[model samples]
Target: MNNTNTVPLVAILRGVLPQDVLAHIEVLIAAGFTTVEIPLNSPDWQTSIAMAIARFGDRIQIGAGTVTSANDVAILSQMKCSFILTPNTDPAVIKAAREAGMQTCIGCHTASEAFVAIQHGANALKIFPAGELGSGYIRALKAVLPKHIPLYAVGGITPANLAEYLRAGCVGAGLGGDLYRAGQSPEQTANQARAFKQAWDACQKR
Candidate 1:
């Protein structure tokens, strides 16, 4: 779970292999990504999530994304997930997560949706399909959003333009394909994850 005070570069492992999960997260943690989100849509995602929590729960904020139901929220929280991310706003799911003590980041496309999500107690707002909107869209959203709402760009974040997203007022960002492209080796994924963390660091220095 994220807060307005701590800006994090969230890593989304959309199709990351189980064997690569620990290795990649180790590299990410070393590179300064203390927060990571694994979508349940991945193969054996629950097992992967458990492995991550068991291995790095003490030091890293392990979470699940693509959540759309209260059931997922309950189970993941019971699994000791530190954070939760949803592709869309679900007031009941948000309330359930809050009651379970997990931080919530729900996807929203417009200011009204964002405002509604915030009103429902979302800790952060994820601008889904962020690439489609581009940094310009984020800037427009930022202009109207409450200064206290943490907005993280996801669904197309990468090293090439992480700085641009940050400049657009996105305090944090999340990436899937750029970091964990399919058909890659565990070692290759580890390497790319490290590179991603480096990019986040570079964004921060700017």
Candidate 2:
């Protein structure tokens, strides 16, 4: 959504608490991350998202992940969130997010799901548990997937193997615990974010 030719790296804050979420996000922003997702499963996620948007909406794109229902989409829309990410390829959720003027990234593990998600107007595809599926799986999927559709590797993604996924044709990735654990200090998270940015930059050079 940043509209750059380079791949977008999403910081996935699964267990971040509202009180500390803004601090962590500031660290991420300083390290060059523009996209961030706070999973709805986190405690008071709505508040975290709202805080992030209110404080730094112009500087970063904040959104909600683990979103499953249209009702959640409506809430995010009202909150003026930038995007919606779901763990599964639910057409209704995708449609709702799109109608609400939010970018949609639907999770998919199989080719069928990927196709269905694309058909439902997903802006991107999140290949979840990508570590288990490997780059080979992505290569296989790429053969059938439209070239314009951006594929993002999520789950178990680390700086070491991120390039491999990129070479396999994935456009981006969702960084979770590898980037920020719930209890990690903001300084620690900033260090990890820098490492990931370096890796992504290196891959782009190749």
lDDT of each: 0.85, 0.91
Model 1 vs. true fold: TM: 0.92
6-62 per-residue lDDT for model 1 (tens digits): 438787877766787898888777666778889988888899999999999988789
Best by TM-score: 2
Go through the candidates in order and give the C-alpha RMSD of each one to the true structure.
1.9, 1.2
Error in Å for residue 164 of model 2 = 0.2
Give the lowest summed-lDDT range of ten residues in model 2: 1-10
lDDT of 2 by residue, 106-195 (tens): 999999999999998999999998998999999999889999998999999999999999999988899998998888899999999999
Q: Cα deviation of 124 in candidate 2 (Å)?
A: 0.7
